[model samples]
Target: MTARTDQAEITALVDRFFLALDTREFTPGWARAYLTDDARMDAPVGAKRGAEAVRTAETALLRFARTQHFASGVVTDAAFGTDDATASWNAYMVHVHHSPAADPLFVVGGRWEATLRRTPEGWRFSAMTVHVVWTRGEPPTAEPG
Candidate 1:
């Protein structure tokens, strides 16, 4: 494929990754959309590798809480190699939870570092690591203080 095509594919894959999370579709089939067979993933809790392991970790996280990962300020850096290519993106994630109330309890903003490889299935994330920058809880009541 051409360099432009590869870059486009990488962008689409990253966009779909967030779409899957928003739709709460963490199934193996869906997870395969963004990850390779031996992908490595690292989060706040821990890290895991392989497709099955990544799926398991994603399932557990989705089950733990209702989350909406809003990725903004996305900037992609792509480098083309002979056969395979690598790309990285910097983004801010606004994590929201829906538990006690139908409101955002916490807004954890962070940066995501992803390493993507070109595959027959298109661009897939071979490794992903998230680094949290800051976390802030929901604002308190504004009645009388």
Candidate 2:
């Protein structure tokens, strides 16, 4: 990588990371597309590291029948250089449950901050944390399997 790499690459990486939640399923190496082998993911439910960390993270939303994650206002501190970079973004997520009962949806507004590093696969997140700023509706009552 050069002193300043292509910022667009980073932006696209951010996009794919969030979009994957919609259709991606849990599988071995599923996280290879976006996370390092030792990546850490901190969510409201909990935190973990290494492969399990990514495994739990990827499956966290499976309890919901459908989920949509939107990432906006992405800001990068070391966007183009440093081998390791920091990027943050605002996310508004809407989740729906399979139940036909009342209040089967929950909406969350949060900020996602991550540490990314260059890997042979590409730009992978070494660490990620979600800070909830606001919420509406009840979240999934069932834990992710």
Worst 10 residues of 2 by lDDT: 1-10
Instruction: Give the per-residue lDDT of model 2 (tens digit) for 26-129.
Output: 66677789888888989997999988887676667887889999989887766453578888899999988877767778889999999989777677889999
TM-score of each: 0.75, 0.89
Query: For candidate 1, which ten residues in a row score worst on lDDT?
Result: 136-145
TM-score of 2: 0.89
- Per-candidate local distance difference test: 0.66, 0.81
Pairs that clash in candidate 1: none
Q: Judged by lDDT, which candidate is best?
A: 2
